[model samples]
Target: MKQIHHILILPDRVVVDDQPVTITTQGADIVTELYRRYMNDYPKFFKMDLLSRLGLVAADILLQTEGAERGAERDDRAVVIVNRHASLNNDRAYEATIQPDNYFPSPSLFVYTLPNVVAGEIAIRNHYLGETACYIAAQEDVEPLIASTFNEHTTSVIGGWLDVTDEKEFIAKLSIWTH
Candidate 1:
């Protein structure tokens, strides 16, 4: 089942360096609706953590349609590719945390050190228990990452880039591919 595809794209949004992203009213409303639909298991969805909030939004976009929830079994798979340009130095802060001389890592920003955390958030929201990975690149290398996934023969991949800086630009695209 080797194939190439382009998933959904959530345009005009941006993710922050070390904080929860600010979304448009349309984006927020979409997330809220999806949470009400697929997240019935969770009684108090609004009070969920920021991590959960981000994940739900990703899941909502990835799993579009009403019955999409039915396909969101534990066997489904997903991957997240965040854009480096989303922020001025979001990755730089992650690096500084581990630097010996400059221990300037902010605790708030440290939580996002694991790129997969966002993936996990989406996984939890949609109950996708297959496989996931997170990568860091400046830009123009997204194809390499996509090709590597093909080499691994992973199907139904959901990949995109989320960048948050002064401009707040987000490019989250979910591509369901198979090999």
Candidate 2:
């Protein structure tokens, strides 16, 4: 069994240790709002998809609350997350770019169709430089993701659920755990 410290990132809020941190402001899009309000300093965040943004915000708060430094060089950590929609929102956006109206398929949008891109983003942001993955499952499950850590040289794991169906639909439950 894994002893874990967790955080929940909802559509319009960010919660750590069962306490909402008031991370978002009054806006139509919470992801954008949260990014602007809490993590606007990271320029790369503007280029990411909605799912990645949610994951980033959640991880940002979770790491901060857990006293983990993002810039610190650490390769012993791993990111293991599960999601439901799994980049479908970006897929739909990419699909629209190739339509008859404007037949220019955007490479930027095309690159984000992969669900693991969010994991990669999180890894890059935090400098984990270790095992990182995003599992596409029917529902949120920690077993497979957590189990992967056991096989790797991972000393700690950032594991959880990150699901984004569209702009307005998403949820992330993340945890920081040590083995």
Candidate 3:
């Protein structure tokens, strides 16, 4: 049977295994706070889009709480992420850079225009080399899409709904599922 460990991150709080772990300050950015608290060693985190940052932080909490390996390649692990917006926040930023008056397209923002980049960021951070996929679907349809990524070679998975909007509203309900 597959055992799943869960973590949910919101702008106001963070929960792990159904218990509240952190109550974020009212105006502070939860992603930045989480990065400062858990990912100070990883400087690259500062450059990622909000979606990637949210996903990575959620995965970090889930994996750390579950005592999973970090900083080592793990071929048995996979990453799957689902969202409704599909990187629209970064896409808007990237679009702004290419506007007619200010035609300076940022390569950094451009890379994050795809939702799959969130999954890639999570995989790269944890050295998970198995399948990495992102799906754009309604919240109700997320389960089957995530389940489809599992296979015989995959022993564990980090996946769930990760969505962010231009106004910085976000939610990351991530899980670590182990066989």
lDDT of 1 by residue, 70-150 (tens): 543665455656565432334556676768887776765665555566667666666777676666675566656755654
Best by TM-score: 3
lDDT of 3 by residue, 1-179 (tens): 25479988877778889898765563227778887887778898989988988888888878788874568787888898888899998898899999999999999999999999988988888888889988888998767776676778886788988888654478888887765
- Tens digits of per-residue lDDT, candidate 2, 1-179, equal 46467887666776778877674353227667766766778998878888787888777767877774469768888887788788999999999999998999999999899999888889988877888887887553576567667645778888688888776667888888886
Model 3 scores what on Cα lDDT?
0.82
lDDT of each: 0.51, 0.78, 0.82
Clash pairs of candidate 2?
none
Question: Residue pairs in steric clash, candidate 3?
Answer: none
Residue 165, candidate 2: alpha-carbon lDDT? 71
TM-score of each: 0.54, 0.88, 0.93
Task: Give candidate 3's error at residue 7 in angstroms.
Answer: 0.9
What does the lDDT read for residue 79 in candidate 3?
91
